[model samples]
Target: MAGLTLSQASRALGKSKSTLNRAIKTGRLSATRNEDGTFSINPAELYRAFPEPSRNTLPERPKEPDRTTVPDDLGSRISLLQQLLEREREAVADLKEDRDRWRQQATSLLANQEAAPAAPPLVKRHRWWPF
Candidate 1:
């Protein structure tokens, strides 16, 4: 069994590197690192991860295909998404409010700093201990 680098495996497997990484992360593919800190992959493992059928090994299925109909949960999903988006919008508004508050506080601090008089510098004391 020939081992391939992650890039080589992706090219040979016709999959992107991110796809391969996701495969490894999801336990779909097994990978190992080379001594050079590069990934070494088994082609067999890649194949097992994303198997391809040769022309001769193609499955024979019925010509008729089932029609795809949207599930009833789709409406609820859309509504949930809408609600999530509204929540996100509210969060953004809250963040903006917080940012404005912080900005005002920062401006006040800067103004106060400008209003305060400068203090005289303290003289440095010599240390006797040598640690």
Candidate 2:
């Protein structure tokens, strides 16, 4: 009556009710049956049967990485990225210039072709055959 009930004992011991019930039934843990048919286990006996888990044996969680601190190579990485962007811009400019030069050469060639006179047809040479 003054001791922990089955549920309370199981919760405090971090074990299931069935486990404690089995322990009590198997005589590994001693408990008094109350008039209401619920088991009342003594804290001393429960601790003796299943000792409290030691906190020291658990591994400590690693501390979270600090986001505010800047890395040592930040400046170098930014400079390298800037240099790459500049190189890409220069390459694009060169490609545009080459494209314009090619377009100009093609238009000139077409103009020259149109300006040349057309050759006369061979109708006179074939006229003797008659229609």
Candidate 3:
């Protein structure tokens, strides 16, 4: 029977190669091994194992309004951009605060370690002679 190689089947089914391998390993799908040690799977079997989503099953997305329908005022555009910039600046401040906190914690930990007494090296007793 006509069939597709593993790569071809993966593309057709929108699945990863590992997923197909797992399906074959679990006996949910069957594939033939080529002489060169590559797997070839029947397209029908791939579809059976991983059915494509039906067109009718997918929810329809709302259409976007036409660009010409929207107002193109310069002040409105500037306000929107300013709002985005403010949000990004706030995000940067938050990140900087977190970094400073972590830095303080790490330095405090290091200070505490340095203040503590050092542990003595272990001394090993040598045997008088080998048995």
Report lDDT per candidate. Answer: 0.80, 0.86, 0.83
User: How far does residue 110 in candidate 1 sit from its true spot (Å)?
Assistant: 1.5
> What is the full ranking by lDDT, best candidate first?
2, 3, 1
**Candidate achieving the largest lDDT:** 2
Give the clashing residue pairs of candidate 1, or none.
none
Per the 3 Å backbone cut-off, how many clashing residue pairs does candidate 3 have?
0
> What's the number of clashes in each of the models?
0, 0, 0
Report the number of the highest-TM-score candidate.
1
- Quote model 2's TM-score: 0.41
User: In angstroms, what RMSD does candidate 3 have relative to the true structure?
Assistant: 12.9
How many clashes (backbone atoms < 3 Å, residues ≥3 apart in a chain or on different chains) does model 1 have? Answer: 0
* Ten contiguous residues with the weakest lDDT in model 1: 55-64
Deviation from native of the Cα of residue 54 in model 1, angstroms: 30
- Sorted by TM-score (best first), the order is 1, 2, 3
Relative to the true structure, candidate 3 reaches a TM of 0.40
Superposed by TM-score, candidate 1 places the C-alpha of residue 45 at a distance from the truth, in angstroms, of 34
